[model samples]
Target chain A: MQEKELIPYLYRTEFRKITAVLCRLFGIEHITIAEDIVGDTFLLAAETWGLKGIPANPAAWLYVVAKNKARDFLKRNTIFNEKVSPEVQYSAGESHEIEVDLSPTNINDSQLQMMFAICYPGIPPESQIGLSLRILCSFSIDEIADAFLTNKETINKRLYRAKEKLKQDKVKIEMPSGSEISDRIETVLTTLYLLFNEGYYSASRNTVLTKDLCLEAMRLTHMLTENKNTDKPEVNALLALMCFHASRFEARIDKNGELILYEDQDISLWNKELIKQGECYLNRAAKGDLISRYHLEAAIAYWHTAERDSPEKWEKVLSLYNRLLMVEYSPIAALNRTYALAKVYGNKAAIIEAEKLGLDHSHLYHILLGELYATVDTQKAIRHFTAASKLTKTSADRNVIRKKIDKLKK
Target chain B: MKEFVMVYRSELMGEIKLTAEGNMVVSKEWENWMGGIAAQNKLVSPGMRLGNEGRVIKPGNVVTNGPYAEIKEIIGGLSIFKADSIEEATEWAKTCPILNAGGNVEIRDIIQVNG
Candidate 1:
């Protein structure tokens, strides 16, 4: 491959590995420093390779540079030397060369540790995701801002506060043990779920679907499944849910990048491989006694991947949504469940349930109301669509809602 | 053929705040542009990135902090390539990947004094 193409592929695959290893060595308290060092290593690689061409083993070259950078940091900074050097010496030896353990096992272990560190309960869910995207996923602050549908300054501040909290709490970069692991995994899974949803149902105007974020979430979740300690049924269920959702990615957006509703989407575009994988995970998830929210959601997602216009699929989806609401009481889930209610039952019954929920403030509620009222009361549907258009922040959403209003008027 | 030096200038070079992924994309673009020049066998020098920290020596053997304190743009790096004329060199400089990062390239012909 060309150096241009190869560098990005390596960056996507190796950047986190290097960062995770360095974070383990320097400790989570100095994560930013580790990130900087890794960033510099890549920059140096680009500069050197542009001139001398790519080395025989580029991955090894990166490791060597990273090691040198770590050594240089330890030697130059008295604070780092005093704090980190002794720990290194105690772990390995007193040799002048700083031996960082970047072995395959250690790399995986470090990533698991970093995942736990990022998902620490002390940090808020949003901030946890911000840190995960920034540290683990290697997303720039600007990119995170775009994902959040906010400004760079806001994202920067959120990341700063999250990292500061980590430092203040002295959050160790290690996997939780036994009983604590279950609770900690919930936080990690929740963060991953949010990350996936952000990509799947992205609010950004420029890009309707952020596929990379979804892929990143799946990649991280797969890591959890690889480790025996974290391969819980819920983790597998979440992976199944992500896979099912990702399988529909190609069908989700049109040539113009407009949103395609589930019913309107072309079924042929759905990825059969990902759907099959989702089924495998869902089947595996059924082994555990605990039926978590992810289990219900995965079942709901599984129904989504079914053949179009199947009444049985709608029935299964509606039942799963009911169970999901009972297990986890979220307004968003309730709103979504009402949509499935419309599919299984009638629009009138769904409208009654949706109205009872008192979600007038949510654009989704208005949009759902608009869709339900389309066939029955065109005027009411138009009003709901107009309300939804006003409530939405992005032009893309507004345009979709406006099109609905225009169709209702006709 | 005449040799020309392409000087990359940008404010981003001063701090280097890009994330690893972002840097990779930028570096990849650089690699492609440089690789193209290499393919044509016109690349003279792949160039060196200037460090942020440096000192300047004046005529009286006096040294001071270099590159000026208040300049918005910093000389990021340089590359040399052979072309038939300044126009051809300018055409090549126009495609420099530095432009993607909101940077500009300054092309200067390398004078051959003893050739």
Candidate 2:
């Protein structure tokens, strides 16, 4: 990366890592203070690096500066001095200087613990996603707003309320113990799954799906799979699911930035490396007898990555979608299953099932119906397509729907 | 080369709410300006950013709030540069990141007496 790009890159990677370590060191209740300190550290870095030119070892420079800034904060904040510091001193045990332990192992452990903390059941699921994005992913409030396609004021208020609740409850930044691990892991994985979707399904008007958001989600999920304490078959399955979807990211959009329907996508554009990684994670996910929604979804997504469309592929996809909906009865999953139904049983069957969904508000629902009706009922297909174009938010979806309508007219 | 201090100032406006990423772009701008000076080997001291609040004591030992507490414009930070003339120093100050934020630069000559 150029010098211009390096700091923001570092901010994205190192900010969360340091924030995790500091939040762990200072206590999660003072997460705001920890965040402020990290912010100050970067600002100081900005000033100092500008004057001094880029340091020989920028990352090391950052850690050192963070340590100094943190020490200053510890000394200056009397509340911490009176309450938090003594316990910290005891933890340090004989080292007069408080160790801002930035060791790789410690950073990894802290981040994993933070992942669980932010995704705690106590925090509402929406705020859990917000907190995870803000603290765990180092996303700014504005970026979170952009990610959710909401305004900053709404997201700001949401985050503030969530953080206030966290402090009041004194949520500990640690993995859930013993019997709680299974449920906690599920919560964390679900948040990760949603985070990935927030990036993947940037279907709203004007915004294209960003790779960074998806990569950050995958990075955190991969972190979970690496940790022995939190690593579960479900976690691996989630990673596998993310990997399979991410592999097709390039193929999903055209050069002009319009959405490419799955059937029209070039199979060659799919990332072989990610597909291999997905297969590896899937194999690991299969080790356990348990079949989470992610496992079923990963299997479904994995089939989509196959180079040649086969009857067998759609059959397996159809079966997995059936199992997935049984495990988790989401309307979106059901909508997707209708496509598999079309592939296997024919358009009429799919159209009948899809219309029953009555998801009139969703452009996807109308588009799906339009697609299913194209071969059988020309008038009905155009009606659904026009409805879909009207309901659709993004120009990409509008273009795709419009092209379909035009094709049917021809 | 004569030394000059570029005292940068800006309006004591309300906080410019920026995302961390947004702050970074500004930071990089400062970096570019500073880097340009350092590249020319004309930079003396990086100087310092004044704290937002400080005390002011008159000769009567009359303590009062800092100039920043009341002043519409406050000194933001300063940097030293070596240039042949004030005009040359002013040239360097023209591209200052502070100016972009609606601040201005005051160029003052540093005089040597003993040497």
Clashes of 2: 0
Worst 10 residues of 1 chain B by lDDT: B19-28
Candidate 1 scores an fnat of 0.00
- The parts of candidate 2 lying over 4 Å away from their true place are A81-87, A91-95, A204-209, B1-115
lDDT of 1 by residue, A111-168 (tens): 8899999998899999999889877887877788988889999998998898889999
Per-residue lDDT of candidate 2, residues A1-410 (tens digit)? 66668888899889999999999888867788889988988888888887878898888998998998888887677655565656677775566577889999999888988888888777788898898988898998888888888899999889888888887888887778968899888888888888888788875433343566789899999988887876789889999999999998889877776678788888889999999999999999977567788899999889988855688987777666665654555667767777877887799877766765657888888888988999999999999999989987777778778889989999
- List ranges where model 1 is wrong by over 4 Å: A78-82, A85-87, A205-209, B1-115
- All candidates' lDDT scores? 0.82, 0.81
Question: Residue pairs in steric clash, candidate 2?
Answer: none
- The all-Cα superposition gives candidate 1 an RMSD in Å to the true structure of 27.3
* Per-model TM-score versus the true fold: 0.75, 0.75
Tell how far residue B91 is off in model 2, in angstroms. Answer: 85
